[model samples]
Target: MKFENLIMNVGYTDTGYSGIVQVVILRMTHMSMVNYSYLVVDHINNQAVIVDPAWDMRKVEQALENTETVLSGILLTHSHLDHIHLAKPLAEKYRCPIWMSNEEIAYSGYYAPRLEGINITPWSVGQIQIEPLFTPGHTPGSMCYLIGNSLFSGDTLFAEGCGLCFDVQGAYNMFESIEHLKKRITPDTLIFPGHSYGRAPGQKFSQVLKNNIYLQFKNKNDFTAYRLRKGQNKLNFFDFQ
Candidate 1:
């Protein structure tokens, strides 16, 4: 089933942004789970970048073909195996660079020696400006990309939940990152999450603030207490593969 209000048109206007950028949400199922990959295209130039491409290269290729957009880069939210599995092959096929957090390269122990790596920093393609926010917690190098008014929040903040914090330190970091996001991102900012774990594929920051219980915590201690009370499973970094 598709999420409600899923955009299908090319010239759709984002909530806060005045300019129209082409964004296609490509949903791919892998290992009995749904993963959402995004194609952000600069329609004027026909240049595009794929974010968190995992499983089903055929669908990815088909999306690119249907949009008539050329892939210029591959952007990774983190180095999770599920997210990066197709990065190398897609970059190789398109002759484009793979952009990721350098910290993830060391933390996850998954290296791409062949594909050219562009350290995740604020950059742009055509008219689209991408600001990479270092929101660690889900992983040491977990990042959220703010493109225009849309936030490509890897595994950091989800619909009503947040990423799993494997340790106490990660939990603290996650809390701090969430606080920071609230300060930086506007109310109308659109959140495009990595997984299809939410009620919808995407959400407005205003709605998330109003609806997300995790974000309702007044302090870090409360957030940590809630996480601890919930008994979140401690994850092994390498086991994600």
Candidate 2:
């Protein structure tokens, strides 16, 4: 099915991940905490993948129960608190490996300060397949996921805005990542970000290509100047990547 066609309401309760593909977007009413996370289930194999699980572990567990799919693994886009607050607990509860980029694995503690030695690196499990793309910029280890044609862009790419680039290096890296995504991912890919601020849950990769003005900046200097003008006083190097 087309990725846009799969979009659904924010509060998709009682939804199960089955069939060829299933996505349930948990409602995150709180500010800076929108869209708890996404559970992508592949019904063909009865396996599941959890992406950026943020709030209500019970809801996630229940989604798994409803779908009759195993909690195969967790994919983290970055080490941001809201994106990964529930990761360790969920991993412990399901005994599933947590996957992320090698960079995130090494420098995740800045955001997840309480976590020590949490195994965060890329490894696949179950029927859900994930191809990791190193899209640093929102943070040094920020990453995105490619599942089928859907890109689970954790703060890296948003519908109308791009991930916040706080540092010069990060901004530069983000520019590169955006360029890479444009060239590598399919135009039909749907973007599922970590937070949408109560907006719809997904956007086509093509839309971001056409509309994300941050990506339109001719150079990193231009993008950095734009961010500075926006009044971002501090660098958030460890927040997005």
Candidate 3:
């Protein structure tokens, strides 16, 4: 479904033990870059949870109103400025807790105080269970939300590329995280990334493995070398130095 200038990709999954869970992707753009937020709704209970609420609250608010689903909580993959700018307002408005990892809380010095929410570990909203996968790299405490067949891979892993690691250690961590994801997540799982920095906003894990160069590295040292070499040319070169 398309709304305004954003595209809403909808997916339905049956959890075998329970009823169906509906996943909706709300794609929006800010600063000439595309950002995506997700709504995972348990239709049977008329409850929903949001992932990475960015700019443009009206669009998000409209989505909630249209679905007639009460906002249960908000999930943050990481505490980046663009991702969490609207989190405070949304959380206050809905009277819901924002779920973020403790690591993210420590990493984001400025935003931490503003985030009056709950720490993300593993929790459930109705029948839709949320497991926080600690995929740190882009920032400490960076995580991916594992809900059924969907992986909300924040800035850690994009559709075609991965996040920019500012230091060698961060690069290594990012590499390890990707390796961990490969071992655990199914190839058929759908990946909803934080930024639309790829050919498409989201893709299946199988397609991502096939197309992403960073995910192909099996050796940590090799991936680290590659990341450092690549980072030298990017805007964060100063950080690497």
Candidate 4:
């Protein structure tokens, strides 16, 4: 059950906290948007959870069949449409619950029969422990899920840059979220961001801190000014990149 030269792909083993749980992550880039849809394969029980299910179901289904795993859950990092388009259909098909931040549900009025608003910090499904870190900035309820050492940052932290901010406060909030991550996660922790943006996904956190220009500002004001500065015109932004 392997596909080469497809991912932005990463695989590793962790002698997990509750004994060894082999972690196999399959990432497929969205056809139009570059959204990194991650399928975390729990080899122990032949169960899997897809982070921000979106785009083609054919690829997802094929991955599941190849890995010989059943979709056990859907984990969302934010309420953005591009990231969440496949949640309900996949949930209905798999009969698995969906997890998203409670704040996002309140703000976006997003609802589903099986969509559960996650309030408590860390919780478990079956044998996996998922901690939803409230990393709001790109949106009010945007969150990043902490599973083992990998951070599934949806529109919050990118590999070489961060997610776009909506306003002044949001820019500041994003700064705080990034700073908070610096304190919380270790250097070796791998970051699997929602989009590739500047660098590829699945880079070590230390590399992000070192290269991400957005992460260098110590003062929130400076960060906000630079982030929200008037050069966001698509025409202008594309020139810089």
Candidate 5:
């Protein structure tokens, strides 16, 4: 579904799930660097969870009011500034726990009284069952969230591209992480990336595998070279020196 720009700068796209649990996923697009934040709402239970809460709160607030759901938790994909800058404030304002990988807390030292460090185990917020996938590439503690068939990949995996690596190690990790995802992701699984580099937000995983260049690399060395290649450093380059 196309994200229709609403009153605010944010573009909203609502997608519904089926089966024993039914919930709606609202995608907030057009954040800094084309970042996308999401709201997983259980309207029947009046509970909601925010994913990678960043940028302005107006768009997120509007989504809450429209759904009549109260924020129950915040899910972080990683510790990057664009993806996690607002976690503390949003969690405080809504009085909810901020959930992230233990690796992130250790790597970035993200501190908060309400911060909850999670493993690969799956959990639930109301009807929405959240599964954490450890896909560290962009950051040492990078993570991706799996809710039903939707993969909320922060920066690990973009629509047709992947996140830049910090070093040779990060690039290797990203390659392995994506290789793991390929085994789990099915054709129907809708990938909701953290940013839109080239393709749109919600694209089928089948299409992604076919079109994504990063996924084409089976050799870690080649992936690393290309990921850290020249001309991409101005904005995304991370200098280890």
Candidate 6:
């Protein structure tokens, strides 16, 4: 999607200092207009990172300005334009790296000067540390991040839904990814999704498992069937419900 096509701004929220990072939701184009853009900051160091920023560059800058947090870099959950639209410009402006899954790079054909792999030990910007996991679903390069007790789930997971499964293999990987995450992280791990509509922040992961029907599917075939059933139809990114 072209930046000129987007007119909405990113949303912001203060997560307090409970080891949970603050979030900013940047609405994007079409049905994804309700998607969330995230600005996660390290409370102690005031250094921050943005996750799946959509389009509004000014809003991201203002969030960093108001919080006194320096933009460290950008993290991508997938190659979806809505998730990565602002990464290029933001990284260019800050001279920061754009962390992403290499598998997604193949799909996006994204050309950026600072694109870097997100698979490795947890990365740190000041006092905050982020562990990126390869969770392919919704897309071949879908990913998720772990920061302290909070999980910044891009299109992989949501408050009451999981990301759409476009690729069957990728969907299987997503199932495996969430299973691993569930085993490794605590139930209390706060979930900050790529889209939350207008709901409050800090939703728990355990709750999603219980409520997300897509996540409860028995296998990839079942999940695929579900996704096909929920096809976009005539909905634009703005009308996604």
What would the TM-scores of all predictions be?
0.87, 0.79, 0.86, 0.88, 0.85, 0.80
Residue runs of model 3 more than 4 Å from their true location after superposition: 1-15, 110-121, 230-241
User: Which TM-score value belongs to model 1?
Assistant: 0.87
Error of 4 at 118 (Å): 0.4
lDDT of 2 by residue, 124-171 (tens): 444455678889898888878877667788889877667777778888
Off by over 4 Å in 1: 4-18, 114-120, 230-241
Q: Count the backbone clashes (under 3 Å) in each candidate.
A: 0, 5, 0, 0, 0, 10
Cα lDDT for residue 224, model 4? 96
Candidate 3: clashing residue pairs, number: 0
Model 5 poorest 10 in a row by lDDT: 6-15
1-241, model 1: which lDDT tens digit per residue?
Answer: 5552244333334334455686688776676656778888777788889889998899888878877989998889888777787899988888888888778877877666444444545777776678888898889888888887788897898876787777788888899989989998988788888775536655789999998888988888888878656544544211221
The window of 10 residues in a row where model 6 has the poorest summed lDDT is 2-11
Model 2 lDDT at residue 63: 82
Regions more than 4 Å wrong, model 5: 1-32, 233-241
All models: lDDT? 0.77, 0.69, 0.76, 0.77, 0.76, 0.70
For TM-score, candidate 2 versus 5, the one ahead is 5
List clashing residue pairs in candidate 6. 11-25, 24-37, 25-37, 26-37, 30-237, 30-238, 31-236, 31-237, 31-238, 32-237
| Best of the two (2, 3) by TM-score | 3
Question: Candidate 5 residues 1-241, lDDT tens each?
Answer: 3343321211122224343322233444442244678777665588888888777688778878887889999999888787786788888899999999999899998888799999899988876778899999889888888777778898898876888787999999999999889987777777877766555666889999889889899799998999888786565422110
The sequence of per-residue lDDT tens digits that candidate 3 reaches over residues 165-201 is 8788899899889988998798878888876543555
- Lowest lDDT sum, 10 consecutive residues, model 4, at 1-10
Give per-residue CA lDDT, model 6, range 1-241, as digits (tens): 2212222222222223345455544444443365567777665677788888876777788788877988888888888777888888898888999988777888778778999865646767765667777777778777788866767788777776667665667667767776777777677777877776434446677777787776677666776666656546544334443
Which pairs of residues have clashing backbones in candidate 2?
Answer: 19-43, 138-240, 139-241, 141-241, 142-241
